[model samples]
Target: MKLTLERSALLTGLSHVQSVVERRNTIPILSNVLMGADGGRLTLVATDLDIEVSESVDASVDAPGQVTAPAHTLYDIVRKLPDGAQVQLTINDDDRLDIDAGPAHFTLPLLPSGDFPKMTADGFTHDFTLPASELSRLIDKTRFAISTEETRYYLNGIYLHSKDGLLRAVATDGHRLALAEQTLPAGSDGMPGVIIPRKTIAELRKLIDGTNADVSVAVSESKIRFTTGTVVLTSKLIDGTFPDYERVIPRTNTKELVLDNKVFASAVDRVQTISAEKSRSVKLSLTDSNLALSVNNPESGQAREDLPVNYDDEALEIGFNAKYLLDVAGQIEGQDATFMLESASSPALVTDSDDDQALFVLMPLRV
Candidate 1:
């Protein structure tokens, strides 16, 4: 293939594609990006078996053909070129892709384009469009709570589905759960709940970070695809069932405490300074109107901080992971963070004082 593309355009498209190609791969073709020049645009594609991304950039096409080259190496060459310089790419008969800018030159060995794997778009049953901002909010709010444990694969992704005109995203890692909801972007009445893998969530987030325009999504039985004008990403969904997360959320915890979120988070941060790295345990001593945050480490030291709150229930003391508590507190957007409790040993329901759309739950730790 032969084409001349703007340096910035090539860099942007390469950044999206090369990120999908892992730094190391067993299959040589999987380590390379497929580039095609046709219809006055250059198409770049990359994949790592389960997920694939493709992007097209406007170019001055002098010839029409396709070739594969090392994704990262090509990206690096273009990225280091002078700003606004046009980059010329050509595939010679010797199977080397030559890259040229104003005064710099580089060549990358090419693999046959036929060896590149392409994900099919068959069996797509659902298609929809959503605003970039709303979709990002849903991901950002729940992705933090996703599990990193490999054995429990179901918790490794954000669960997305639509019901009763509401689209919800939920994630949990056994220790804590996060749920966020928004109005359904389009028809998804019969769409099955999908457990999107952690890698796919991360890739989608990067794809949407550059544009504010509306994007389209298509879902098949075992795959999902997102597309903007120039970028397209297709990923395989996790082949597992997510647990009945609703059962994990406590619905009857009646003890309520509301405190300024900024104050609560800051106090917890101060108290956790003395916590041991392994346990990270913190105790919350609660009374009519005061909450005390404290941590003790036998090998080091102890810390305690008190904050005022609005609570008139029976006094209680609860033990929780300091990191978990702070994570939940950071998600609270209102002036006050609300906690609903059953006892010192039960899980705590966390949310904003008035908003009900997003919820967080934290499991208690034994002191």
Candidate 2:
């Protein structure tokens, strides 16, 4: 392929696709990016077998063709080039890829384009459009709770489904759970629940970051595709089934405690300084209208902080992981955070006072 484009345009396209390419590969072709120049555009594609990201940019096509070249090496070269410099790429007779820009030239080994694997997405049962803001909110609120434990592969990503006329995203790691919802878009009725893998969720998140354009999503039993503008991302869905997360959400807890989210998170952070590094436990003692946060570690020291709250329930004391508590608190956009507690052993339900669509549940620790 022979094409000329601005350094910025090429860099943008490379940055989007190169991230999916792994640093080490067993298959030689998998290490290269497929580049095609035709119809006044240059398309870049990179994949790691499970996920693929591609984008097209305007280019001056002198000779229309296709070739495969090292993804990381090509990206680095184009990224360090002077701004506004014109980048020219061509395929040599010896089956090598040539790069030229502003007095610098490099030759990279080329591989056959036919060897690149593409994730086939044939039977998409559901398709929908979601506003960029809503998509971002759904992901940002729940991703932190996604499980990193590979053994429970089903919990390693976000669970997306439609229920009660709301499009919801749920994630959990057994210790903490996060759920966020938005009004169901028009085309998402009767969509089957799907588990989006953690890597795919991260790539989709980065693709939609800082953009106001709507995202076009297509879902199948085994694959999902997302398109925004000229960029398209295709990923294989997790084959394992996600557990029923709704069963874990509290329903009968009536002990209501409302307090400033920032204040509570700060207190947890401060008291946890004297907590054991292994458990990082923080204790919350609640009375009629007061709350006390304390931590004790024989190896370190003891710390406590008192704050005023709006609680009228019977006295209760619970211990929770300080980091998990802070994580849930950070997701609360409202000024006040509401906690529904039943007993010291039962899980505590947390919610944002201003956002009824989001919910959080935290399993208490024995401190």
Candidate 3:
């Protein structure tokens, strides 16, 4: 294929697609990116079997054709080229690609375009649209709780579902759980719930960076796809069923405390410094109007912090992994957070005082 594209345009598209390509591959073609030139535009595609990303950019087409070239090498060459220079790429009869930009030139071996695997758009059962910012917020808040354990394969993804006309994303790693909900869009009714794999969520998050445009989502039993202006990401869905997260959320807590989110988060970080090396546990001693956080380690000294709170319950002491509590606190958006506690052993529910859309549950860690 022969085409002339601006350095900035080509580099942007390459940066997005090359991240999906692996450095080492058993199949040579899988290590390369498929470049198709037609209709005065250049489309780049890369896949690692589980996930695929495609992006198109404007280019001056001299001879419309297609070819596969080393993804990382081509990206590096274009990245090192002079800014604002025009890039010309052409495939010669010797199965090599010649790249010319200003005073620099390079040649790389090419693979047949036919060898690249094609992703099929099939069996999509539901579709929805949402602003990129809101979608990014949902993913960011809950992704930390997604499990990395492979044995429980189903918990390795965020569970997207519709409940009471609300669209929610829930994730849990057995120790901590995050649940974020937003008002469902008009056309999101009857959408089938699916577990979106962690890789797909991460790649989609990168593609939506600094973009305010609307993103279209399509999902089926087997796969899911997210599409924006000129970029599309498709991936295979996890087959196992996610556990019933609703059952774990506490509903009968009798004690409540409201504290500044940032202050509480900082206190947790400080107290955890003296916590046991492996357990990372911190003890919370709550009084009628005071909250004290303390940690003691055999090898290290002890730390304690007291903060005034708005609680009137009887004095209670609870122990939890300070790291898990800090992670949940970071997800709160507003200044104040509400914590509802039923007992020292039961799960505690935490949420922003002004917003009920997002909630977190943390299981107590034995100290």
| Among all candidates shown, the one with the greatest lDDT | 2
Q: Residue 95 lDDT in model 3? A: 77
lDDT by residue for model 2 over 56-155, one digit each (tens)?
A: 9999999999888999999999988999999999888898988999899999999999888877878998999987788999999999999999999999
| Cα-based TM-score, every candidate | 0.97, 0.98, 0.97
Query: Tens digits of per-residue lDDT for model 1 on 245-305?
Result: 9998999999999899989999988998889888799999999899988888888888899
Q: After superposition, how far is residue 347 of candidate 3 from its true place, in Å?
A: 0.6
lDDT of 3 by residue, 123-179 (tens): 998888999998998898899899999999999999998899899999999988998
What residue pairs clash in candidate 2, if any at all? none
Of 1 and 3, the candidate ahead on TM-score is 1
**Clashes per model (N, Cα, C within 3 A):** 0, 0, 0
Model 1 misplaced regions, further than 4 Å: none
- Overall lDDT per candidate, in order of appearance: 0.90, 0.93, 0.91
Model 1 residue 250 CA deviation in Å: 0.7
Error (Å) of candidate 2 at residue 31 is 1.6
Kindly indicate the candidate among 2 and 3 with the higher lDDT: 2
Question: Alpha carbon lDDT of residue 34, candidate 2?
Answer: 94
Tell me which of candidates 1 and 3 scores higher on lDDT: 3
Question: Which candidate, 1 or 2, has the higher TM-score?
Answer: 2
Candidate ranking under TM-score, highest first, comes to 2, 1, 3
Which candidate comes out best when scored by TM-score?
A: 2
lDDT of 1: 0.90
* Segments of candidate 3 deviating more than 4 angstroms: none
CA error at residue 162 for candidate 3, angstroms = 1.2
